[model samples]
Target: MEVHTVSETPPDRPPQSGLVRALKVPRNAVIGIGFGIALAVVAYLARVLELLGPFAGTREYPVLGPEGWFLVLAFVLATSTALLVASVLTVVEIVRLARTVDE
Candidate 1:
């Protein structure tokens, strides 16, 4: 029988926790699929609400104007970028997990 104890000393291969664990999700392809999906969903909603680029100028439209479009685009881009990066990290984590020696 063998027992492994948790200690402050890091393992030769560090154990994952928190966000690291989240990134290790095996399902993500890490090719920006989630980012693309989320962006599409958001864009669809914005268009449906008549809140896209055409209405982005707040001063011109007083509602859903240029500012609105800029805000929406900025938000969508930022969120998609973050998700894409996270997805890539998840891919790396999955690969690392695959290579780890299992007890």
Candidate 2:
């Protein structure tokens, strides 16, 4: 006579619901925003340190100088980067979710 042995591995979990997966979009956006901000800060610092080059544009106003322009550019760059990254991640997540559901 032969005896059967039991396995200890846990069963695989069911795929997450679409809504649950979708909820991660906001988290992805936040991650993108953080990355963008970090990138902008680094770029700004490099420009300020003359690593890029000396500021040549004439200052139109005393308060808003080249530094201020850099800040403005950084803001735009960060915002755009955030949007792009968020959208891309969202699409990728959706596709993955769809594949999993189909399977």
Instruction: Give lDDT per model, in order.
Output: 0.63, 0.83
Using all chains and alpha carbons, the TM-scores for the candidates as numbered come to 0.39, 0.69
lDDT of candidate 1? 0.63
Could you give candidate 1's per-residue lDDT for residues 1-103 as a string of tens digits? 9999889876586456554555655445344556665666676567656675555543554578755665667577756776776667777776776677462
Per-residue lDDT of model 2, residues 1-101, tens digit only: 99998879977887766565575777888989998998899888988787878868755746787788888989998999888888888888889878998
Clashing pairs in 2: none
lDDT of candidate model 2 versus the reference: 0.83
Report how far residue 71 has shifted in candidate 2, in Å. Answer: 0.4
Query: Candidate 1 at 17: error in angstroms?
Result: 8.9
Task: Go through the candidates in order and give the clash count of each.
Answer: 8, 0
Alpha-carbon runs more than 4 Å astray in model 1: 1-62
Model 2 regions lying over 4 Å from their true place: 1-23, 55-63
Minimal lDDT window, size 10, model 2: 14-23
